[model samples]
Target: MLRIGRTPRQKPGGLKARTGIFGRLKKDRSGATALEFAILAMPFFVILFASVETFVAFTGEQVINAATDNIARQIRTGQITFNQGKSTDKTRTEFRAAVCQEIAVMISCSASEAETPSKLFIDVRTVSSYDNLPPTLPRTGGAGSDINTAGFDFAPGGPGTINMIRIYYRWTVITDLVRPYVTNLRPAGSSMPNDYLMVATSTFQTENY
Candidate 1:
């Protein structure tokens, strides 16, 4: 009779205690959505930036193609007429500058801007033959190479002739976050590895002019 009121029997496995703890956690869903949003934000931004970079790269390629085609037409239609009286070297230099300027405008590049000129590599070649042709590579001259000699042949006429005008442009994403995502964004077989190059080659017959 003097025994204290018998303590309530303890739950056999503490299931009630565990259930209470878990039930409280389940009820507190206030921060769950916030945690999920934080987890997803990074990848979403990455994907968005990647998409923008990809679009810029494609737009650049199309612009280069258009400029190349225009220049090639000029070369093929004899608009860039070869004159025996004028120095071919001088004429070719002017032609390259003109074409490069055209491409600059197409891709929103500034020809006068020293910081990004090298970013737009414009190589125009007038190859006499494509046989046993070495891969087109960037020249390392102090003044840089001419557009007409940058790539393969864009000859007016010759045996097994292929008149080609190649335009190579490099675009560097100001943002490094998206650079790795783009494909073949740089020049073909280019040694400069960090930048994306866009190349456009237009080949036609001189006879067609």
Candidate 2:
């Protein structure tokens, strides 16, 4: 029969039953968990990686501090002397070897890099008095700031002298996401910022040998 004024609508369970399908889709919760995880995963992973890198960086500092103390003790007790040109006198290269040996577990330096190490910079010098010690980290600034190694030398004075040993290392940071907050160094020629400078200094008076 043909409808006269208004056509009759189909029933809920009838052939044209789109209302039920739409309602069921609206009530579905299948993807809710995945959606929540996707929103939180990025921040969670970032925090996790930052924590790990911080711990590693701290451990590296401790290793450096211990090495500095050990090397300074040798200087204090006359076990290692410098600049006298004696048979047992230690040169700059020998001093670096001792330092690398102390920190080998955390940092490695091969035989070839002993003369000019890429990662480590060491300074051993005699100070006239306790008030005359050099700055722990000396920087030369103009265009780009860098560690000033110009006055750095291995001239620890002989017996009954005050000496200081300072060590600097350019630690390569791998996690770039937290690098800006972790360090202020912007290594020259690098496309991205990545270095965290670590410094350790020790001062003591040499024993009468």
Candidate 3:
């Protein structure tokens, strides 16, 4: 007669070893902090970079605004005249130089202010009324369109005339994570958005000087 004795119960050493190893792994907290920190680091750094970039963008906007007001004041008071036949006559290039002199600390400008291919775009003209001022941004079509500078001109009015100064600067975005939301400007036909268009406009009547 064969006695079925539970097959002599095989030793569970290997099973116990595996179970013990798994238990030890579960109890180990050596790498827990590191793992959690690794998981949180991505968002932490993203927020840091985004915050820094936003502050920088705000500073840039203020810089351009100040420059616009200063330049507009000069044009309004006859301190800066365009294409006038006089010893103090200033050209568009000179006007750009004047603007660059104020904003060069924040934005880049060529060594020669008269140089073309600048990131700064300026539109100064005489307007009959505020309603006649440009109602739209200097964009061609969509948000991804290239800046339309074809209609831009430098024709500041004389004394007692109404003049408008509109300045646009293509601010290079540093943080890639916050670029697209910062501005709607992007190069035409390019999938990647890059720049933050900074705009400043001043409309006022030139003082009778």
lDDT tens per residue, model 2, 166-190: 9988787888787866665665665
For candidate 3, lDDT tens digit of each residue in 1-209? Answer: 97776657766899989999999999999999999999999999888887888788889989999999999998888888876665656878888888888897887687764557468889999988888888887778886676899988889887788899999887888888877777568665657777777889999998888
RMSD of each candidate?
7.0, 4.6, 4.4
Top-scoring candidate (TM-score): 3
lDDT of 1 by residue, 1-209 (tens): 68878789888678988999999999999999999999999888888988888788788888788888887676665565454243332244466566666767556555553233455554344455666343654454322332333343223442234565556666676556666556443333444335566777676665443
What lDDT does the true structure give each of the candidates? 0.60, 0.83, 0.83
TM-scores for all predictions = 0.65, 0.84, 0.86
Model 2 lDDT, full chain set:
0.83
Q: Which stretches of candidate 1 lie over 4 Å from their true place?
A: 1-22, 84-90, 104-106, 113-117, 129-161, 183-193
Q: How does candidate 3 fare on TM-score?
A: 0.86
TM-score preference between candidates 1 and 2, better one = 2
Q: How close is candidate 2 to the true structure, as a TM-score?
A: 0.84
- Model 2 residue runs over 4 Å out of place are 1-19, 85-87, 142-144, 188-190
